[model samples]
Target: MNLGTIGIWSLAFTHGDRGEAREAAAELEDLGYGTLWLGGSPGGNPSGDLATAADVLDATDRVTVATGCVSIWEQPAARLAAAYHALPAHQRARLLVGLGVSHAECIDRYRRPYAALVGYLDELDAASPPLPASARIVGAHGPRMTRLGAARTLGVHPYLVDVGHTVRARSDLDTTSLLATEQTVILSTDPEAARHQARTMLAPYLGLANYREAWLRIGFEPHDLAHGGSDRLIDALFAHGTPEEIAARITKHTAAGADHIALQVVTAHRTLFARTAWRELAAALC
Candidate 1:
């Protein structure tokens, strides 16, 4: 995998205009972000996911475009593999297919999450897609998927997790496998203001069991996830401080065994505003 030190993970296309997202992609590439990661959310359609990757791939020269995850239920993995393989050679090399068994509550059609993911990967493999194993990733948290990540793909893409989870995730994968984790960041210098913004952004995730379990494993209690999120929980989940402090938090994930950190800046505004934060973050991290 050619995953560099850091990547910008965004839901901009999911929530904002595509043109704005494309512009942000170009700007991030200019700012030296190595990859652009697009994630699948509940009730999201992944035609947008492919389009987001295409827009970023078209806008930038060297930066990779990744689906931080496209749920197995959302689309056939074979079709996704075909789309990835059909991109220009350079784009194909720069494109990463990230797969995941999404939230149980959201998957109405699939009865077995694990089985669906396994079948999806099997279909992709049977297709003999152009991308190599190194060019694919999986959204994994618990041990079963973590081991499957090692056996089936490049590595794991864990979300809303801390350094402790990174440590365990790294130990589960082969040393060469990519261990990429998403870290939420807030650029404000005021702790109270930052956590306030982080809480608003993180509220939905705090209720999701997948993320709640990960947080609990890192020592947060159920009560910590309540009422926005406890100070300690917000502080642990989001890197809220000066730009330098935020960069340190992202780098800590790397030191804790993450090969690349995909950053999601918790902001109250638009893609360009978020891109500004990304610029500062890239400068500090790179």
Candidate 2:
């Protein structure tokens, strides 16, 4: 779908009021982001995710809208396909559906995730108006799933990852697969302040085994993953410094073979609007 080299990933679009969300989406498009990725996993009900994507589509003229990932266990393949087909052709063309087999800790039905994902893809293919493999991407981390994503779907969208993982994932993927990675950025110059913000955003992820395993696979020691993540781990996963420094960190991902980098700006206030950060980053990176 030509998601461009840079995009903005935000959870606010999923949870915010429609009017405000639309305004933010429009501003992001005006700022020249190629895609707006709605962050946070969609729960058992897929309606919210679809509606959010629709809102962004309605508000923006050209930028693509994607679900950072909708869990396969939560949202069935049939219903998701139906929703995708219902969209107008232009909207469908711009929409990228990112699917994931959620963590074992979050879903009771998380057994044989790779097999289940294959079955889900089978269902999608069987739908009346099929959801084409090119229209979707998989949220994959490990080599096996990453390879599966390359073979079965558009490519892999690895979340909470560093450039090192991007290098490894690129090596694992087929030449045709798209490699999109998410990077969290905290725009504070103070070392302690920046790390504090990074630690706050990273604490919950440290508890998720999926993310921990991905870190270990990329050469992180146990100590580096503990106590809200060591400085080394946080530095690797997040770009925290001036705008120029953050821009440099993002370039590393592009050099490591990431086709797209979905940048999420971290702020101390969860309710703060990120258009300002988006504008600054667009000036620096776009």
Candidate 3:
């Protein structure tokens, strides 16, 4: 997992046009982002599929393309393992599979999530050739899963996190494990405008218990999670303002113990190829 200091995680990559996504991915690699995280919503991809990851990997030569996470309950280990082997050797080399036990509210079969994740790992281990632990990542936030990620796979990919949680997660794992944290940002100078984009992007997540618990554990109060998140909550989770200001916030994660920061830029208009924002951020970030 040679993911450098910065990567781009895009929700639109999974939601928009594939051809455009491939082209954007190639450009991002040229821009110097180490990884391209396919940001799918919870219980999405319906079958725990890796097709989107495959598309990004096929388009780029060097940058690692990750799932951000595909749910265990949604896709079987054998099917996922098979999909991994289906890619060409070159593409496979640059692919990173991120797995998670998504929120119970979104998954009907969600039960004993931790235990289920353990079992899923077991199944993957039993697969033909197997999806190598070195090529996979765990979507973890809590202590137990964070430790599991350190011990089992490449490392943890924590989403919707603050500097406080990154520090604690690093403490839970040994220094060798990759602490790839996803950061949401809005490249806007106006406070009101930024919050609106942040809130719109945050509303669906607020209802998910997995992220809710992670936020609370990091010292966010119940009030912070209310009504599309409080100003304090929005401010804490999102990095807004100019490109330089946002870059500074992304750096906070690195200082707090993050090995890699997967940057997700949120804007009022949703599009897969967010070239302008990526280009601007790369000037300050990469």
Candidate 4:
């Protein structure tokens, strides 16, 4: 469950294309990163999503691959269970399935979202091809879901979050459970320019209620959430500065009790994997 450091969280598929999700995975592995995390897809067949992870597992030898999460509403438990069973036993350990009960608006056609996830886990447990409980993680934010994650999966993968929520989530789970947080990084020395970039990049999450509430809990004011984000909000969530400063931000998440901190470089540069942002941060942290 120790999904390793400096993974890519590209929303590239949204704006354009991922080429092959596995191609990015292969490059990330070659970059010396320890994991490849993919998400931002609201709904999709679980098997196909799991197959994406499988492609990465097949392409690389060391790095673990995870869904930053796949919506429980979109995919069935049996589907994920089958995918988990299809992989070689050794490969299975390297594939972590992160599940989530997504936003209500996004899950409109699904029945009883929370209950549905509980049922899905139950069905997964009951399935002929069940995954080891340790191979799956949950995308939980609030207390109830956090508790569910603690009980049902390996740990929690909370997105658009900070160390404060990481602290709270760690407290909610058993000490052994994993808490891998996603931290956004933009390597810019200018404070105004750094935050401007951070704000523009964070515009979408600012609209999600789950993220809005989580930011509020971390002391971000309602006004701070407006438009893009206030400078203060941007500064706290996005790690922007020198590479050393970015490493310091990632370290803060570890200090706050995160088992792993997924570093995302916020840039329009498609060649980010080959660029300085990833290399500099990787050298600094790992």
Per-candidate Cα lDDT values, in order, are 0.78, 0.87, 0.88, 0.74
Query: Model 3, poorest ten-residue lDDT window?
Result: 40-49
Q: Residue by residue across 24-107, what tens digits does model 1's lDDT show?
A: 878888888888887567544464347667777888888888886777787776677777777787777788888877776666
> Which has the higher lDDT value, candidate number 1 or candidate number 2?
2
Off by over 4 Å in 1: 45-49, 128-131, 269-273
RMSD to the hidden true structure, all candidates: 2.0, 1.6, 1.3, 2.6
In terms of lDDT, which candidate is strongest? 3
Query: For model 1, where is the 10-residue window of minimal lDDT?
Result: 40-49
Q: What TM-score would every model get versus the actual structure?
A: 0.92, 0.96, 0.96, 0.89
Model 2 stretches with alpha carbons more than 4 Å out: 42-49, 269-272
Clash pairs (backbone) in predicted model 2: none
lDDT score, residue 27, model 4? 64
Task: Report clash pairs, candidate 1.
Answer: none
Instruction: Please provide, for model 4 over 18-135, each residue's C-alpha lDDT reduced to its tens digit, 9 standing for 90 to 100.
Output: 4555566676677778777765544432334476667668878888778767777777778778878988988887888878777754657766766887888898899896776788
Off by over 4 Å in 3: 269-271
TM for candidate 4 is 0.89
Residue pairs of candidate 3 with colliding backbone atoms: none
Clashes (backbone N, CA, C under 3 Å), per candidate, total 0, 0, 0, 0
